[model samples]
Target chain A: MTPTITAFETSPDRGQGLARDMRVRWSLEEVRQPYEVRLVSFAAMKEPAHLARHPFGQIPTYEEGELVLFESGAIVLHIAQRHAGLLPDDANARARAVAWMFAAVNTIEPPILDLQNAKFQEGDKPWAAERMPLVLDRIRQRAGQLSERLDDADWLDGAFSAGDLMMIGVLRRLRPSGLLDEYPNLAAYVARGEARPAFKRAFDAQLAVFTSRQPAAG
Target chain B: MTPTITAFETSPDRGQGLARDMRVRWSLEEVRQPYEVRLVSFAAMKEPAHLARHPFGQIPTYEEGELVLFESGAIVLHIAQRHAGLLPDDANARARAVAWMFAAVNTIEPPILDLQNAKFQEGDKPWAAERMPLVLDRIRQRAGQLSERLDDADWLDGAFSAGDLMMIGVLRRLRPSGLLDEYPNLAAYVARGEARPAFKRAFDAQLAVFTSRQPAAG
Candidate 1:
């Protein structure tokens, strides 16, 4: 079944591929699944319609017939479970991969989101300076742990699964801060994720959204 | 296989059932699955052995034979997938339930955790008073969105699947702030989860850990 996924009509990230939809796109690309995109504007996102699809009214809601799914982590997992490449064939390995998926969003991503808030959400506030380091510290602690676990491994686990897809997605958001560089192996790890042809295709597809929207040269 | 899980030696919430382990315990109880718990000290959690089980050095890591999994969301999902009662028989419904799991942690809990940081982690800072409203606003925005989506529904999807289990666990954290009371249906929804016999047993079990640790009431 072809799933219909939502994305920002005019993304605030300016097509950095940092949007949650990029993960969904990457997951689909990894599994070689053909899907459809339905873009929604910011104003339309908060309306009852999008909210009906996603309680939080966020983009990247997946609709496949009767099932309406949100949360990029879950959407990717759903796709991975049905498809083969994103998950391992072994039962135990599959559960571990799922653990990495949750770790990426719940454990790893929260501090990253806190970092985003420190910069974008609260950058103008008087506390930005005072609060920024604290946020950065939290990110450093998590990144340090992740770097240690990853060590010299090419992927988080046996092979590239949806777990790496989610983790790299979260880590990519950290590039603007340059914190990812502090841990050389993690920086290399992110580079490895980017090197995947599937990731490049997804990145270019999302980036195209912004490039196409760019005003014509004078 | 009887799985083993981990929890705090003395939970910071004072047996409030706010720890991620509560969700795992609740899930085990719902499936009527017998399990064992191993308590970890804060110092031990950061040590190498526990880090091996959980890179994040947090509680609620699941181990059954060779399969060691961390992240309460992932653990509970693992249990639900392997057992009955916690998930729906319908494949699509199960996927939707998984979406709620991600929503509770990713979309819902981040704002809640920000509120936690504002109060517990950063309450000492000079910006505490001025910056708190921003965190609360973030929480309020998410809670308001959740409330609208729930809209008098008994569960987020249907029939109290793991989705409801996760959402309830996330919402229970808000009780101390009284924000949950603002959303009557959501508050009742949490209450209904608490009233379940399985939830009651899990709550009592975790609460017992704290009670057992307390010094004699002198």
Candidate 2:
């Protein structure tokens, strides 16, 4: 069965592939799984039907037969577990790959998310200006540690597993902040991930959604 | 062979079971797995040895034979996968449980962690007092949504799984904030988790570490 995943009817990022649905789409492409996408509007996402699918009422929910899963990390892991090419065969390597997945979302992404909250959510607040440095510094600290660990490694660990997929996805969000450029290797790592054929296919698929919704150019 | 995990030489929370180690310990206890603890001081956690085990240099790192893992969510999931008690036998249920684990750390915990950063990290800043409500409200939004979904249910989903374990661990951090109390059901849900015998054992064990280090009364 071809799994169906939800994405924004109109992505806030305007098809920048920064919204989490990109992660699920990229993972499916990597695993060579041809799936369907269901675009949901902001209001519809909060409706009872969507809320039942995702308690948080967010997009990128995965539904296959009786299974319904949310959280891009979980959905991506689900795809990786059921298919090949996303995780390594060795048990230890697989476990490490998963560790990196959790690190990407739980460890690295939180600070990045904070940067967003500071900029968009609290940009008007009086404290936003002064607090911006603190938030950026936090991201710098994690990115620096990650850069040190990567230390010219192609991926986080032995092959380009789901860990790298998720880590690169998270790091891509930092491009606008310009902090990623500070770590040359980490920036290149994101570039490498984006260069993958699977990533390009997924990126184009989501971008098409936004492009199609735009009014025709005069 | 018994696996070894790391904890703080002196927990900042003083054994309130707030540190990530408690999650691993509680999961191990739930699975009836005997394990050893390796305590690391703040200084030691940043050293090369600990950094090797955990690139981010944080506790608790799980070392079982040849496999080493970090991220409490990953460690707990590892224990859940290897042991019988923590994950549901059904594959779909198991995936949902894993989703909850991600939700706990990613969705729920980020705001809670932000509250911490606002209070402790920038508590001395001039805008700390004014900026506090925004941080608290973010947590409340998630807590409210969670409470609505949980309703009167005993757990997030069917029978207690690693999902509940991780969600409960994350919610426990909100207790001091009082935001959790706004949703009485969520608060009681956490109480249900604490009432578990395994939770008690885990809590007591971590607490013992802190108490043992206290100065003797004259």
- The most accurate candidate by lDDT is 2
Tens digits of per-residue lDDT, candidate 2, A63-170, equal: 999999999899988999999999999988888999999999999999999999998999999888988999999998899999999999989998899999999999
The DockQ-based CAPRI class assigned to model 1 is high
| TM-score of each model, paired residue for residue | 0.98, 0.99
What is the C-alpha interface RMSD of model 1?
0.7
Predicted candidate 1 versus true structure: per-residue lDDT over A78-178, tens digit per residue: 99998889999999999999999999999889999999888888999988897888899999999999999999999999999999999999999999899
Candidate 2 chain A, which ten residues in sequence have the lowest lDDT sum? Answer: A8-17
Model 2 lDDT per residue over B64-138, tens place: 999999999999998999889999989999999999999999999999999999888999999999989888989
lDDT of candidate 1 over B12-52, digit per residue (tens): 99999899999999999999999999999999999999999
Off by over 4 Å in 1: none
